[model samples]
Target: MGGKQPVTIMTDQCSAMDKAIREVFPKSRHRLCTWHIGENAIVNIKGVMAKDGFKPRFDYVLKYTDTIAEFQHYWNSLMTDYNCKTHKWIERLYDLKEKWCPAYNKEWFSWGILSSQRSETTNHSISRRLHKTNGLCDFYKCFLDVIDEWRSKENKGDYNSSTGNRYYSCADNMLCFHARNVYTIAIYLIFEQRFIKVIGLRCQRISYEFLVSEYIVGHPTKDFIRHVVKFNEQEMVVDFTCKSYGEIGILCSHILRVFIVHNVEEIPKQYIMKRWTKEAMNTIVEEGEDRDNEEYIGGVEGDGNVSNKYVRDETLLDVIEPSIDTVLPDVVEPIVEKVIPTMIQNPPKRKRKIKNGTEKANERNMRPKGIVEKKRNKLKGWNKRRERHVDNLREETQSTDKCMYHKFTCWWGFGSSNIFKFTIGSICSR
Candidate 1:
C-alpha cells in the first residue's frame, strides 16, 4: 500500500488530510467532486436549473493556468444576476475561490473540491442511528452520534434516491419569504387544462393558522407565491388569478412537485371547497327556525314552502367550483406527458450484392456498414485464387512443368551415384 500510492486524488475540501497527502507525495492530479458543487449551488439558489447551471462555471474555475482571469469573469457574472442576498453564501463562495483561483495563491488546498456531498451524505447516514432515542435531549445525542456515521453508510451499502437531490429537504425553498415578512408554500394546479397557482401562507414560525392566495401564469411562481402568503388576512383568495390559452397547458414536474410538498391533509377546506362544494351542506335555514326536526315526517311537501327571497339568495351558493383534486389531474396530467418527440429519420438500409458490374455512389454509401469492406476483401481473394489456379494448370500441361510439385521426393546424389556404379560394373565385367 505504501509503494502503490495513488496518482490522483478525488476528495472534498479538507486542510489537514490534504497536508498529509502532500507530505507523502506532492505531485499528483487533484480534482474536486461534481456532486459537491451541486450541494453548494442548492444551498444558495434552492432550485433545479440554477443549481444545474453552476457546473460549467465551477469546471472553468478548475483549469491549471489562465484560470483565475477566466474564473473571475464567470464568478462576477454569477454574482451579478443571482437574486439572493450575498451575505449568507459569501463564505462558501469564497472557499471555492480559494481552492480554484491560482492568482489568489492559496496553498492550504492541493486541488479544487469536486464535492462535499459524499462527506455530508455519510454524516446523514450516521445520524439515522439515533432514531432509537426519544425526546429533545435525544436530538443532541443523535447529532453527536453521526460524526463517525459518514463511513458507516458505505460499509452497510443500500439504495437511497433523494439522499442526494435534496429537493425535499428543509432548505429547498427560497429564504426571501422571511425578508418579505411572510412564509409561503404554493401548489401549481391545473384545472380543465387551465393553469392555476395555489399558495398557502403562514404569518410567522409559531402560528398554526395559514392564509392563502392564488396567482396567474403571467407572474413568476416565486414572487406570486410570496404574495399569496403575505396577503392572506381574511377569506381565502380562491381562483384569484387566471391564465390565457397560451399559458394554459399540461403541468410540468415543477408544478406537480410543489403540490406534493404541501400534502392534501395540510390543505384547508376553504381553499378547494369551491370545487367540492355539496348541495346538502349548503342547504338553507332561516336564522329564527328550530335547528332540530324528527326524521319521521311522511310524504310531506310544501306544507309551508320557503319564500322567493331566500331562493334567490340561495342561488349565490349554486355556482359550484369543482374541487382541486379533480383539477389536479389536469395539473399533474392523468397520463404522463407520453408524447415523446420523434424525428422522421430514414433508417439505414441493407446493401444488395453487386452481381457483376461496378457499384453506384448510392450503393457505396448504402453498404451495410461493417459487412461491406469484409465482403469486398473476400471477393478480391476469390479472384486472386482463380487466377493462380488457371496459371498452374497451364504450366502443368506445357514443357515448363519443372515447377510442378510431385508428391514423391528422390535424392539426386543417390540416383547419380547408382548410375555411375552400374556403368563401372558393366565395364569391369566386359
Candidate 2:
C-alpha cells in the first residue's frame, strides 16, 4: 500500500520472523502476543504459578498498572515472594516485558488489541472454505467471498452509524444527543458507558490552579476504585490518572465525571479522536482542475471542528443513471437448453481372466469412500445468483403524497442544498 507500514505487530516469538520484521519494517514496533505468552507460561511453569498464587499477581502486573514504577515493584515482589527469580521461563519473560506489557507500552495506540487472538480468529473464519485439494480457481473464489463478507460487515456498520439513534441506559441529555449523532454505533456505546458511570460518581475539587479533582463512588462494587482527574481550565485540556485515553484513545469515566461537574455542555473538539469516529474512511471523488481526469481523495486529516470541501457536479448524474430518451436496438434472443439431473447408479462388475485361462473369479480392489470424505451440502444453494426481474423495480413517474424534499434535505448535518454529492457505490465494492 503506499509508503505506509504497520505501527506495531503482535505475533508469537520466532527468531526468523523477528529478523524479517526488523529488516522489512525497521521503524515498526514488534511485540509478543499476550495470548501466546500466557499459554507458554501455563504450559511451562503452571506448577510454580498455581502453587505460589502467581497467576493473578502476574496478570495484574501485566494489565492493571499503567506506570513503569508500579509494574517493576509488583513484578519484583512477585518473583521474590514466590521464589520464581531462578525460573528460566519467568526470567526470560521479564526481560521482554516492555514488548507486551500494558504498563510499558501505554503511549502507543494499539486500538485495544493486545494479542494475536484477532489474527487467529480471522484464520479460523476462512479455514472452513480452504482445503489441501482446492485448486487455484477455488482458492481465488474463497478469497473474494471472504473479502466480500468483510466489506458487507463494514457497510452494515456505516448504515447503523448513519441511521441509528444514540441510546443510553440512563438519561444524560448532553451526551445522548451529541455523542450518538457524532460517533459510530460501536464507539457511541463505549462513550455511553463512561457517561453513565459519570452519573454515579461524586466529584470534589482538590485544587483550583491545576483544576485537580477527585472522583469516588459510594457503592461497594469491585470497580468502585477512586480516580483522579486534572484539567487545565485555560487550555481546555483534561487528564485522567487511569490513562485510558492515552492508552486506548477513549475518554474514561473519571474525565467525563469532571466534565459533568464543570457543567460542560458538549465534548471538547480536541478529545474527539478521528481514528475512532464514523468518518474515519470517508472519501470523495473529485474532478481535477484540468477537467480531463478524475481522482479519488481520501479522508481529511483536519481538526474535528474543520469541515471538508467536496466537488458537486449534477451534470455528471447521467454517468450513473440511464437516459430516459435513450433508444435500444432490438435483436433475436438465443434459446438455451437446460441439462437434466442424473440419478446415481451402481457400477457394473468387471471379471478378471485367470492366468490359467479357466473361469475368472470376481474380486473388488478398491474400498468405498468414508463418510468424512463427503462434502457438506448445507451451503449448496446459498446466495446463488439469478436473473433479475427489471419490471418489478420499475416505478410510475407519478406522486400523490406531499414531498418532504425540504425536511429530508435539511435532516441532521446535511445542508438544505445538493452542494455535496456522493455516490454510495464504493461502499459495497471491495
Candidate 3:
C-alpha cells in the first residue's frame, strides 16, 4: 500500500481489470476468484457439471491435487471422460489454471484465501449503508464510515496485542511460557494449538549428528500422512518438509513435536518471525522514528523510502506511541514521552462566538412570524382533508356491510345464512 506491492491480488475474471493489474502491478501475482469461476461454470455448463461425479471430480482436481503433474493428469482425464474437450469455458479455465489452481500456484503464499469471496463479503457490508441512487458525497461519506469501522477493529487488535496477556496451564510446562508473552493473542492460540497437538504425535529418530537430526513423525489421519522433520540442535532450527513456516509464517506440528522431543525450552530468535509477534507493528514504528529521534537514539540509518516498513503511517504510530512507551521495556522505551502529545496535538485553528440565551432568543425571533403560521395552517388543512377522506371511507364501508347482510338473508333464507353465521360464530367462540 505504501509503494510496496502486494504478494497477490485476487479478483473476478474481468479483462479490463486483468489488463490494468498487469500494467500497474506487474510484479504482483494476479489470481482469478475461484468462487466466481465456479459460479460461472455452474451457469454455463450446468448439464455437464450435474452429471454423476462430475462436480466432485472437478473440485478434487482443482483443490485436492497438490502437484502440477497430478493436477494435469486428473484434469485431462476428467475432460476426456466427460467429453468436455469442446467446452469453451473449460478450455479457458485450463489456459488460466495457474491463476486459480492451488497445485499450479503453490509458490505464492495466498494465506489460504483462494477466492475473492471475502472481498465480496466486505463489499456487501459496505454497500448495506449505500444505495445506487446515492450522490457522490453520500457514497464518499459511506466509504469513510466503512473504512473507520475497519480501522477501529485494527486499532482494537493493536491495543489487545500490546496490553493483553494470556496464560495457558501448558504455558508453564514447555516453551509455551515464552510464546505466550511473545506472540499476540490470536497467534499465541495458534502456536498453543501446535504445542497441544504435539502430544498426539509419535516421532522416531531416523538419523543423528552432532547438531543435526532427522525424524519421522506419525499422527492419526484418514490418509495417514507421515511428516519428516529436520532439526539443527546447535542453531535451534527446525524444518518440516511441509514448509508450513515458509508458506504460512507459522511452525508446523512436526517442528513443534521435534522441539518438544529435543527439550527446546524457548523458541530460537531466528525462528521467531517478528511478523507474528505482538510487537510486530510497534517494532516497525520504533524503527521508523523521526530523524531527530533516530539521531539521538543512535538507531539504524536508512533512506526514508526503505519500502518495507509495516506501520500504516506516522499517524497510527503517533496514536500508539504513548501507550507503547508505558508498556515496553525501559531500555527500548523513549525517555522523552511528554513531547509525543505536543507533537500529536495542534493549536486551535480559530475562535467562535459563544452567545448567551437572550441573544439566541433574539435570533430565533428574527424569523418571519408569517412563515410559522403558514406551516401550522398547512398541517391543519392536511389533517382536515385526511379526516374527511376517512369519514367517506366509513360511510362506504357501512353501506357495503348493509348490502351484504340484506342480500345474504334475502337470497338464502334463515336456514342457509343463519347456519353459515352460526358455524362462523362457533369457530370464533372456540
Model 3's number of clashes is: 0
Residue 173 local lDDT, model 1: 34
Q: TM-score for every candidate vs. truth?
A: 0.22, 0.62, 0.58
Model 2 local distance difference test score: 0.59
What is the TM-score (0 to 1) of candidate 3?
0.58
- Stretches of model 1 off by over 4 angstroms after superposition: 1-7, 13-23, 27-29, 47-66, 83-90, 98-430
lDDT (C-alpha, whole model) for all candidates: 0.36, 0.59, 0.66
Instruction: Give the number of the best model, judged by TM-score.
Output: 2
Better of 2 and 3 by TM-score: 2
Give the TM-score comparing model 2 with the true structure, all chains together.
0.62
Which of candidates 1 and 2 reaches a greater TM-score?
A: 2
Model 3 Cα lDDT, one tens digit per residue, 336-394: 56666676686333333345533222233333444224433454576569656644533
Model 3 residue 290 distance off true place after TM-score fit, in angstroms: 12
Give candidates' CA RMSD values in order. 38.0, 23.7, 25.8
> Model 1, 235-302: lDDT tens per residue?
42222111111122222223322333333222333333221222222345434445333222222246
